[model samples]
Target: MQQISINTPALLFPAITLLMLAYTNRFLALATLIRNLHTKYKQGQEDRNLLRQQIKNLRRRLLLIKQMQASGITSFFCCVLCMLFFYIGYEGWAYGIFGLSLGFLLLSLVLSLNEIYISTKALEIELKDME
Candidate 1:
């Protein structure tokens, strides 16, 4: 295995930061939607079943976002540990940690994509109501 420079893992910092930012934005939007739905329900302006379904979808999406964030954080932590190991001359440990970091990042991304798909389906449900 080729010796990795500390800079290699450092490259993921910005990418991970941006991904977390996007996930946070999605979470905030979902929160706002839930609040609006709650208000509508309180005012008797929303159908009960539709509201229930929407809430269910939102709950699942929120869970996915939580998992995605957790994975992303784990990836970032592993990346930092990889750098630390490399700096201390533990090449084998550094390589293993780096691999774990990549795996966790991939998991985060997959969860994010799935959440996006669910979000789109929620939008479709709303659009259908408008038709």
Candidate 2:
């Protein structure tokens, strides 16, 4: 059972992909918004209030993405170490690796949710905004 499970990294693939996609989407949106803001700012026509809010939102989303990516990388490293230990006959280390992976997984999920929340709130404000 352990060998069968260990042989498959498939379980993490979808989750990793989803997190990557979410992070990319947030970054792309941030890029576009930043470009627009820069243009408006240069034109001296920027809506200060809205620009302030947008910048704040972008900062938040970026922070979440950074956290997710950092955690993901650490988790991957732990997985590699786990596999090495397993191959070396140090089976006890698997438990530690399992715990690390689980923690990172939860961290990524929480970060994803946080990004979603920030995105939704920003959208809501932008939609109702008259400027």
* Cα-based TM-score, every candidate: 0.96, 0.82
Q: How accurate is candidate 2 locally (lDDT)?
A: 0.74
Off by over 4 Å in 1: none
Model 2, 1-131: lDDT tens per residue? 34523544345656666766767777787778778878988998867888888889888887887887778766666666666666777777765785687688778778878888988998887887865
Global lDDT scores for all candidate models = 0.93, 0.74
Summarize candidate 1's per-residue lDDT along 15-76 as a digit string, tens digits: 99999899899889989998999899889999787887899899999999999999999999
Q: Candidate 1, 97: how far from true, in Å?
A: 0.5
Which one wins on lDDT?
A: 1
The clash tally of candidate 2 reads 0
Best by TM-score: 1
